[model samples]
Target chain A: MIWDWGFALEILPVLARAAVISIEATLIGFALAASLGLVLAVVRIAVPWTSWTISVLVELIRSTPLLIQIFFLYFVFPKFGVVLDAFTAGVLAIGIHYAAYCSEVYRAGFDNIHRGQWEASIALNLSSWTTFRDIIIPQAIPPIVPALGNYLVALFKETPLLSAIAVMELMQTAKIIGSETFRYTEPITLVGLFFLAMSLVSAALIRSLEGLLNRRTTR
Target chain B: MGIRTLVAMLVIALVVIGALATQESYQVFMPGLLQGAVLTIEIAVLGSLLAIVMGVLAALARMYGPTPLRWLATVYVEIFRGTSALVQLFWLFFVLPQFGVTINAFVVAVLALGLNVGAYGSECVRGAILSVARGQWEACTALNMSRPQMLRRIILPQAFVAMIPPWGNLFIELLKSTALVSLITLSDLAFKAQQMNQNTFKTIPIFTLVLLMYLAMSLVVTIGMRLLERRASLGLARGKAA
Candidate 1:
């Protein structure tokens, strides 16, 4: 049949479970990316000796496709005696791939902070850690929230790549349902709709968050 | 040596050492990976050309067309941009065949990549066009130039310069995305890498080679786009002087 409502209903629960996997992967991966990205940015700034190495590593990650990285982690790491399950492998690949992007965003935010703030912090005898925590990070983070949110949506969409190594996320689940029932219209369409809805909701949330941050800053 | 140069040399030395370690597998995998790399470039170039056309049309429709056309453009951009490109590819590859519409795998790859990038490029096009000075539009109207003449002669040249940098990013994104086409059974770089991995189980060498190929392609795209952007801006500068 062209479009089977019954088949779509039959597969809803399965797809929904897979959707949870997709969402969880996105959230966990994004968390790893955010923290790792911040660390990379900090190292590039704070440790001059290592900055070039960090820059090259980030560029190497950024230049390649996420699919290749996933394949490398999934297939290649086992050769080095690091045998991660598919889920962990997918998360690590996605996390590090996007950490490159998030680091760039963080770098931009840090660059935008005025030099006078650093000078003032130094004048006040604040420890570097206290200065970053009290003065710099608060200023840097608000501006980059929207950019970070965009990556969140991007990461959510990218969770489908996990399927290549057999993680069985939403798109993979949809593909299985399609093959089983020989009905492509329902499950695939539903998957697309689910992505579109989640993206729109996240975009809306990001906009409001940006506005809230801006208002607080202005006040 | 400066720290940057020293670090760069160190990284190169490490890479050369790693390559020496995997030297034997290079002969087995290089030819297939090279062939796949060519296909990846082919897909990226063809897909980018289509995306630029779609982007310009959709951007114009949204910007200056009638309300219905604007609405249609908005819907197209939102739906395509909001969903995963992988889903779009799967839909084209798997779903269309069910409806008695059969497109070859290569064409499906091009269309899906083109459409997804086009949706993003449309926003850049729209933003660049809008960013053109209000006075330019008013000047064209004052001169009694027709809408087409105004767009072709005045607005588009300025907007084109603005669009190039974002278009470059989209082009690179399209190149990276071509790896996804391997899923539909195209013998692109990622697919060849996978095939070689399964055949030899030399995963480290095979994947490292594929990753470097992709990085090399990305560097080519980045350099190529920079040249294009420079040329476009030079033309714009000469136009202003004239």
Candidate 2:
């Protein structure tokens, strides 16, 4: 038989546990991306002199493949006296890599804010912090939520790359299972289905989030 | 100009020059890496061509083909797009042989990456075609052009320009994805770097060279696409074309 139902059923539990690691990595990495990306975006905007250097950094990170980035973090950083474990390195690599892409999205979000809004905040005698926190970010973020959500899904897909560093995520776990049982079909197919289902679910959720934001913004 | 920028620049320069300064070590690594890069470029180019063809075909099938073909194309896009390229690569490389169908790793790499990128490219094609003004389609109908003739002679040329930048992005993406092909035991640059690292334990130089090579390749794609876009839009100059 091409696919053994019993074997698939037997391995489902092991794959599910590993999937939690993948999900945890995605959530934590995305949180880092979302936050670090905002900092990178804000730094680029606020520090006019630093913009050139920041952009070059962003471009450098963005252009290189994430796998190499992960490998570099895993393999090379120890030479510089910074050591990180496989999972930590994988998550950090994923976080920093996506952060570059996310910063661009956030920068675009910040750009859409009208100049008058900044002027109004200044006219109201608000501190820069108050202006950004109370006025600017709230406005800037809603429009870009959908864009950020897309990255969330993108980051989830990238969780599989962590397997390269031996992070024991779903993909790596499945690979191990495949090697152990020599049944690549079931474990790999299940992992693919899990990804497909999660992506579809997240996509639908993002659509609803878009609808929610649109209605709130329109009001 | 600032200290931070200077420091960053200096660090990068030192790393790069440090890697090159040692001629003995450079000789050890550079040749193997360059050979791997050639293979990487070959796969990327072939994969990109296949992606463009599959993209245009799938986009057309989804947009204007018979209902079943449309459904098939949609499924193709969603399935391929939904899964990570790595999974798709492993499946083809490992699983397909179970059914008594075995292909070489290089063919598997190209097929997997091409089809995967093609799924995303179909959307680019669809978006570009949709962005072409509604009036163009009307004019084609008014001229009594057949469906294929209208798409071929009238609709596509205009959409082709809009598609270039997005296709350029996809091309770079395809290039980066070529790195994944290394995972399937193909001797691409990434694979070569990993191999050399294992052998020589010179992580810094080998990986740095590989990263720089990829960055250079992506920059070339970016520049080439910009030139193509300029050339494409030349005939469609706004006032002149009208």
Candidate 3:
């Protein structure tokens, strides 16, 4: 494959702009997932009555493909009077999709919190909310930071699925460039490199965060 | 029954009723979706088989082969694992043609899925092998066993057990990922769903049905993997007993 420097230079600015949208989608979607996942995990643990429903909902979300979920939100939801623009629907779909996975990570962290910690909180007569806030979550979250970071990287790679709904993400921009120039190598390869760089950087960050957390726990 | 079980049952019943209520649409769309579903299964099965082969070879090369081979394996794993699968698929489908290599869509799907999942699967293989314990290697050496013999007879059998669950996950992930092939104009389940939606304008039922179809396929893969895992672990238990 021939590498065209001039073509690459021309497309760099457009691809960079699209990359910003991709990064924003990943960050926003991840934020939504983190909070929603925590809520799901907490509700499942705290309310016995809702645990079954929540678990089923999580499983259904996890089992289905994210593309279908995005399409359902973008296309089907409009018929149901819940119209969403491509970016909003894409982010919401991604957020909800990853929320299922994130909740499982949160659940694992919650499960790792020792029973004695809970009983000790009871002995101290702390409110349940206070117990979770003070005793459980602090210990639980540190270990899961690495796992959560994985989903962040995964979510970043998956942002291209938004292009299916016509969100002007990096992948879509590359496709447009390819169609216009009829030269696929440079634009697609650049997008791939962008993803690889982000993934490696995120992984390194997660590793250092894990090390920091471990040192604090040991100290 | 527990209240939890009752709630789950009620949800299942509602889904069943909803599915059945759309019997007419099901008749119209079922044939196309079923055809697409078959293609999806074909892609998953063929892709996973290719992935397992690539994973084993790459893992071996990375762990014990020459430095150049090790670097090759590492690069393959990192590049595939880091990038978007859609980009890879597009690269193969769109870009390869420019290089005077035009593979059909199905072959492109299989190659992309296999290579992508193989990248992830190699890690599972490498991890399982490394976890087989240092003493086992020493013992094999002490017995004057060759590297291949030791790996095939002692190491891989045990590692196979450990690999099953993660491989199961990879298989399901691969199955879900096959949906992306639809974007490349492969007429897979997702493509058929899109086509049906365009024709019928029954967006909710059409997409819902396709979603359920995918879920059903994933469930099947999961159940099959569980059975395979049980068989592998059973052999492990039997080996220990003997």
Candidate 4:
């Protein structure tokens, strides 16, 4: 079939509308992963018993595919008499799946801290809390900002998996439009373009955020 | 809480959720999860094998091939790195159908994943090779080893150990990406979960089991990789390190 600019133009608005859902899911998932990851990292390192449990939890989460995990949360919770909407389930699954990865990132950060930092803390008679907060974390984060930024991009791209469970995210929306018109080209193409554009924007935003954080850390 | 108590609580919660929930009938879900697990492995192993070869070749090309070949490899690496795998998946599956050559979903997935990993693996291979010191190459030359023999006997052995760990991670990612194959009606874990969701209307148990199956497979892969890594690294890891 010849490329149809007319069909593509007509589908742009619908794709744009669906882009909103994808963007929203990414935002909320990012926030959740960020916070939950911190909680996991702190518990794993601070309390020995807590670390043991957290390690198991982290391993369990990390070992599985996020798509399957999303399916689990989407399918299973309803049996416990807690029925989540498709959108809530999708986003929760994505966020929960990613929290595991982010925790590992934070843990990797801590691991990179040389033993000398701990020695300095002891020599200075500083509490572990003060040492970690003031000295160790500051030094650890800069080198890892780029990697962390990469995960955020990964999390954003994964929003499409939410569509499998009927979340009406960009891809799902495009699929519906494609079916209605029998014009898969227009909707799917636009959806791909939308994802490409948004992800590029996200990469730029993360870079700026990394730059700002680095500047603040240096000062 | 103690670690035991915490795990007990989570297990209890999962059990309760599994018990009281009115998920789909077990029969439909059970067979499907098992079959999907098998398919997941098939795609992962085969695709990873493809990726390893392509990755090594691309790495070698960039390091020693003609200028144009090196440039082509570089562009391939950067473009794949810059884009999301999901986009790559869709393009391979959906876009290819428009060209009147609709390969099976499994092949599409294998190709997309292999190509993507190949890009990432090239860097690992290149890095591993670079880490092989000039002294080793010189020693090989002194021993009257040809270029190919030097690579096979001296340089590659050192580089291979370094390649193992990252390749393991990439393999896990490959396994996970295989779930996307369910979208093309491939009867994989994700696909089976979808079918169970459709037939039983019991989303949770079916999916939880599917998730566990994935976790189990991934654990096996991870543990196996670690063991191999330990063995590989035991003697200066004499081969590839990436």
Candidate 5:
């Protein structure tokens, strides 16, 4: 196929414009995943039955493929009277999927708390809430910054899943432009390049965050 | 918490799912759910097989290849690991078709998934191999075994055992990722679910069924993997347990 530099250059604006949607989906999805994950982690930390049930749900979500979940959500939820829009469905699917992963991150955060912290809290006549808020969370949250950042990076990549639900994300924009121009090489190459650029920047940012966290921990 | 006591609760959960599934127009949803489940399996299996092969190749290149080859492998790993899988799939299926290399959706989906997961799995493979200890390599050389012979006889068996657990974890991940392939229009579980949802307009019932089916399929595979892990861990010391 003859490569069209001009065509690829033209699509750059279009793809970049659509990138906003992808970023939006990612942010919304991450927000949902973060909150849901924290809720489940808190429940798991507090109640055995809640934890067990949540574990089963997490396992189920984790085991099955993500594309399938997206499909189920986009295609099936309206039947029971919850008619979600493409964007909502996409965000919800991404949120639920990543929440499973984030829960593991949060659970790890929980696990990293020294046993003595809990014992000390009990010894001090602290309530469970006080123990968690004043002691456990402060200790547990720092190490998790890097892991949660990685998940955020992952969530950004996964925004293209929103394309399956017909959201006009970055990749979907590329596909449409490519088909419209009948010049795939340029647009496709640009997409790869675009993703590469984004990933590199995000990775560097995560590393810096890691460094910052490390410095804080040492102090 | 007792076996008989919890049985009622477990039954209730199943009943709830079933009840939710059928309290609306649902017959069409079952076929779609089953279809999506099958597609999910096919994509997961094919993608995972590709991932294993690519992973091993990638690990080897990273481990033993010439400088440039190792560099190339590193580039591949970093790019894939850093990006979202959905973008990769869209690029492969839709973007490539515009370039006049119109591959089938299934192939595109599988290749995309394979390459994506392979990048991650390569790390697992490398870690597993490295964990095999420098002592083993030293021991093999001390026995004066040929390099290839030593690798086959002394190192690979242990490495293979270590590879299985990591491979299983990657497989579970790959299974979940196969849903992205539906964007390419393959009649996988995700595609079927979407189709049925569109036709029936009973989205909740249909999707709920799909979720249950996926959970069931993944649960079975996970349990199977656990059993394999057990068998590998115990080895032929079966009679010791017996």
Candidate 6:
């Protein structure tokens, strides 16, 4: 009836195990998003021919909800003979959805590079790939680190949506515990606390990373 | 591509999709989805209004309230912002009943979403207010205006222009979040799509329709906010001159 400390203590291990799955989803999903986003951003800028389509695709993904996107992948792709397990579908959905956003951040980072930098790279007769690798990305990525870090936190929070397709992430695990034991207060409250603590930790880490980057750049 | 070419192509694509959706097969799902869209829009509208009010109040409290009030506002903003919206919704929907508080699902959806978005909105509000030049506040004080009077006539009008774009963003985020309310059994657009999919197993058409509907709503919000930003900036110039 009331908050039970014993029950809360008992479920801590279960929640911790589930939290690892959620963490795995977040890390993998974020890595996918960050890389895919960089590729999307570079394609839009470097290859003039593909810019419009890429831009529209990014817009469509960014505008739609991630929940529906996950459903589309998990549910609809089977009709096209490309069925994916729930975890895969959920990870792909989150990665693609946030890639749209992360691409914009990358684009903004790229835009901050002076026009002279590109012209200089061209004047030096450097290949586009070499220019992007040696000149553009190194300068662009540092500033956007904080923004990407925030998305890492965001993706972690979103792993619970995987539970909609039965991925057994933290929230879903907690929900099951609630259903079986009929005491949601402990598990759900613990889930909330886990999210809060993780996000705060990530936020602090991001701040330190920002400071470190600033020091290196300035030096 | 040229803007004209892009618009023309987009319109053509929509027409093609629209014609296909008119077939009897797809028509069966429309009424249910439309009903859900209506509820989604309703929740988004109500949630946005509540978010704005809470945001402004919290920002003001954090900035100008006494120490205790500021601390309370800080905790509210941090706790709400730090946790997931779905968790907030579930805690409200499932856990509160144990505490003898049984809110209707709709109320819980709006409240959970409004409070969640409001936490982020407060930061936007705070930033906008802080960006209002210190000179403006001093000028208001020089004219012997009270804090509330200064905020009403001078500070807010200026900060409002800055707030519109971020508020627009928060509103769209709120709209996307309404999809989560379906999990609580409110049957909003996303919920309706999943329900229809379960029954008919027509996942592709159903999800495509729902995604497009969501895209259309977000586009409308985007355009509306852009127009409002333009109007606000125009007013901002007049305010600045005065």
Top of the candidates by TM-score: 6
C-alpha lDDT values of all predictions: 0.89, 0.90, 0.89, 0.78, 0.78, 0.90
Report residue B155 deviation for candidate 6 (angstroms): 1.0
lDDT of 2 by residue, B22-131 (tens): 77766678889989999999999999999999999999999999999999999999999988899899889888998789999999999999999999999999999998
For every candidate, what share of the true interface contacts is present? 0.86, 0.68, 0.72, 0.43, 0.69, 0.74
Clashes (backbone N, CA, C under 3 Å), per candidate, total: 0, 0, 0, 19, 16, 0
TM-score of the second chain, cand. 6 = 0.91
State in Å the error of residue B216, model 2.
0.4
Model 6 C-alpha lDDT per residue in residues B92-135, reported as the tens digit of each score: 99999999999999999999999999999999999999999999
Chain A, model 6: TM: 0.98
DockQ of each: 0.69, 0.64, 0.66, 0.39, 0.51, 0.71
Candidate 1 Cα deviation (angstroms), residue A20: 0.6
Pairs that collide, model 3: none
Candidate 2 clashing pairs, residues 3+ apart or interchain:
none
Per-residue lDDT tens digits for candidate 4, residues B1-242, read: 23354345446545644553445555456666778778888988988998898899899989988999999988777656555566677767776677677888788878888888888899999998988889998899889998889989889988888888888888888888888888767887788778878877876567766766676567666767777877888857353564
Model 5, clash count? 16
- Model 5 Cα displacement at B230 (Å)? 1.2
Give residue B79's error in model 4 in angstroms. 4.1
Compare the candidates by DockQ and give the number of the best one. 6
Task: Estimate TM-scores for all models.
Answer: 0.93, 0.94, 0.94, 0.83, 0.87, 0.96
Q: Ranking by TM-score, best first? A: 6, 3, 2, 1, 5, 4
By TM-score, how accurate is candidate 1? 0.93
Estimate candidate 5's alpha-carbon lDDT, on a 0 to 1 scale. Answer: 0.78
Categorize the docking of model 3.
medium
